[model samples]
Target: MNIVVCMKQVPDTTEVKIDPVTGTLIREGIPSIINPDDKSGLEAALVLKERVGAKVTVLSMGPPQADLALREALAMGADEAVLLSDRAFGGADTWATSTTIAAALRKLGFDLIICGRQAIDGDTAQVGPQIAEHLSLPQVSYVSELELAGDSVVVKRTFEDGYQRIKVKLPCLLTTLKDMNSPRYMSVAGIFDAYKKDVQVWGLADIVVDEANIGLKGSPTRVKKSFTKGAKSAGKVYEVDPKEGARIIVEALKEKFVI
Candidate 1:
């Protein structure tokens, strides 16, 4: 089987800072890592590869620096890696981004596609499902568990309250959760071999996409503004009996129209 994992490089949230003047992310000195959920998805793919002898390919769309993320995927046991980079792809929103990635997936061909539920930078959680829609493929999101069956896969789709197990046929897409699997680390030999392998870089010309349906032109959503959160006021503290405290809390909620 050929498994394609869509990965992304995102700034480490802990190290992220906001630009006070521009109201945008300060990425100059911030380090980047593979999106945590995507890393787990990659681990899931690698596990399936080991169990069923499948070929795993990691794909990412971003600036050229994204190649580093792909190289890390190789070091974690992916058979191949592809980086989609181009100036034309800049400023793409979820729709345009999914369109471009779906185009590349068509070229690569795959029996299965894996993606994180959402990206850290953009928490819309729309790209994976959008890609499935673009390709007219069945998709299951928030997959917590999966097992390969003949010509199909049994997956457990998670929910806040519980989960549902469904058997879906091959050629489907799955958006995985970070808790699905523990990611493996890059070993010394794997790291050495990763450097030896070539990471294929493709631009807009390499994939088939409409000029109007990619980049900022195709993006329907725009960020009007961005800013850091303001400091919150301290909470009120009161010393009272349990019954009195409950009454006070209820009264406070009523005053705030929260209840």
Candidate 2:
């Protein structure tokens, strides 16, 4: 089996800051890490590789800093890593990002594509399905359990109500949740090896991507405005007897028209 895992480098949630002036994420000088849920997806790919003796390749799309995430994957047992970076890819929304990744996947040709259910920062939960649509591949999202049976893939997918088991053919896309697996830590030797390993970097031109359908110009949605979520302090707390506390709660509710 030839498996591909899509990973992302995201800003540390606590360190992330939004530029009030440009209405964009301020990434300069900020710490970056692999999206947490993507670690589970990478683990799933590694497990699959071990079970089926497959070649696992990790792919990521981001700025040059994203090479760090790829190197980390290499240390975690991925056979190879590919970095897709270009200035033209900046400010792309989920649609454009998915399109770019799908095109890259087409170039690589894979039997399966694994990705996190959603990125930590964005949490849009749209890219995986969007890539599936772009590739015209069968897709299952929020997968918790996965198994390979002959040429088919069986997956347990989580929905609002509960989980549903489904089977899909090869060349499918699965977006995995954190509950899927526990990611293994990289060994000291693996870390040292990854330090000397070279990650393949590809640009839009290298992938032979159409300029019109990728990056900022190819995106239909534009960021008309961007702003950081306002900080909110905790509300008041009351100290009183049970009866007094009930009265206070009622009064506050009435004041807010909640009663």
The candidate that wins on lDDT is: 1
Least well predicted 10-residue stretch by lDDT in candidate 1: 223-232
Best by TM-score: 1
lDDT for residue 210 in candidate 2, whole number 0-100: 75
Candidate 1 residue pairs that clash: none
TM-score of each predicted structure versus truth: 0.94, 0.87
Clashing residue pair totals per candidate (backbone < 3 A): 0, 0
* Candidate 2, lDDT over the whole model: 0.89
1-259, model 2: which lDDT tens digit per residue? 8899998998888887778676677779888888877889999989988888899889999989799999989999998889989898877888889989998899988999999999988899899999999999999999999999899899999998998999999989999998888999987888988888889888878776677888888899987865667767898997879999999889989999997
lDDT of all predictions: 0.94, 0.89
Q: How far out, in Å, is residue 214 in model 2?
A: 1.1
> Which stretch of 10 consecutive residues in model 2 shows the poorest summed lDDT?
223-232
